[model samples]
Structures are given as C-alpha cells and as structure tokens.
Target: MGASSNEAEEINDWELPNGEENKKIEEPQETTEVCARMDALGKLSSLIRNWEQNDVLTAVAVVGAVTTMAMAYSCF
Candidate 1:
C-alpha cells in the first residue's frame, strides 16, 4: 500500500536533511580504512597463531609462578 501523507513526511524527515553529499564522498575512504585495519589484525593474529599451544601454556605458567613467588616473599 502507498504511504499515507503523514507517514511519507515522517520518512522524509528520517532521511538526512543534510550531509548526504559529504557521506557519499567519505564512503570510499571509510571502506579503505576498515580494510586496512582488517589486514593488520589478520597479520597480528597470524603471528600469534604461529606460537605453539605448549609454548603459550608454559609462558603463562611461568608468569603465574613468578607472581605467586613475589606475593609469598612479600609476606615476610
């Protein structure tokens, strides 16, 4: 069904009263920045993925042991 006049007017108000031209200009730049971010994140993730699970677990255990030892020594 066709929009009633009030509904049509409300829809028009929901559309940008201004800045449509600016958004059209910025869209490509926004997309490019997002893609660059995604690429960097993928590279970072791959670096982390290169670490073996055993290595990560051992590192975590070492840190935890160090923290526990420090806390115990501080109790003196």
Candidate 2:
C-alpha cells in the first residue's frame, strides 16, 4: 500500500522544467518560414524543370510569354 501510494505523487511531479518545456514547444518559427519559402521556390523550380523536360523552354518567345504570365499571376 505504501509503495503504491508514492507512485501517484512521483508521477504528478514528473515534468520537464519550464525552460526545457518552452524550448520544446516554441521551436519551428524560423523553420516554418524557411519551409514555406522552400515550397514556393520548389514550385517555381519544378515548373521550369517541366518546361525544359517537354521541349518548352527551348523557345525564347514562349519563354517570354510564360514568364510574363507567371509574373502577372503572382502579383495578383
């Protein structure tokens, strides 16, 4: 009974200190921003890669028009 009684108190007090708790909980702000930028850049990069893969980027005229459309879409 005595050993069993101590278990609840011990478990109740088991906690990482406040600083460590904050360190664990409050991370990922910079990581989140970096990941978002990486995602946007990856999307644009993949589009370029696809254009190249399909023999689309070889033409300067089409490249110009596509880039203009991209710029307009992104701005709006």
Candidate 3:
C-alpha cells in the first residue's frame, strides 16, 4: 500500500512544528551582540570613529573620493 495522509503530515511536523511554520525564528539579544562584534572585527569603524572626533580627516576623505572619481572618468 501507498503512504497515508497522516504519515505525510507527520513528516512535515518533524521538519517544522505546527505553530512555528509561519513564524520567523529569532536569536536572543546576547547572541546578536556577539555576532555583531565578530562580524565587525576587520572593519574600519575605528578609523571612522577617529574621523568623527577630527574634522580634517573627513575633509581629506571627501577630497580623495572626488579626485579618484575624476581620474577614473578621465580614463574612460
């Protein structure tokens, strides 16, 4: 004989429970903080934080972006 309907339903319940099918599973806040720290380790937030404390570095960044874009467009 072929598989019955209840067996198929049981298989789906084994994969995901009844009420949680439509709900999104979320991690706790402590896990979120740990993941954020791990993800940001190699980023340049330290430099950005220093630029926030100093105005000269921000101005240099803006000027560098404009000069680089100008040189790039000139070559095309």
Residue range 1-76, candidate 2, lDDT tens digits: 3557678777665667653322234554567789999999999998877675447645877889899999999999
Tens-place lDDT digits, model 1, residues 1-76 = 8999999877665646674522334443468889999999999999889999998999999999999999999998
- TM, every model: 0.44, 0.32, 0.30
Candidate 2 Cα deviation (angstroms), residue 8: 30
Model 1: lDDT of residue 22: 22
What candidate 2 gets wrong by more than 4 Å, as runs, is 1-29, 53-59, 62-76
* Steric collisions counted per model: 0, 0, 0
CA lDDT for candidate 1: 0.83
Predictions ranked by lDDT, top down? 1, 3, 2
**Prediction 3 TM-score vs. true:** 0.30
lDDT of 3 by residue, 1-76 (tens): 9779999887665534655554456986678878888778746666566655358777998999999999999999
Best prediction by TM-score: 1
Q: Which 10 consecutive positions of candidate 3 have the poorest summed lDDT?
A: 14-23
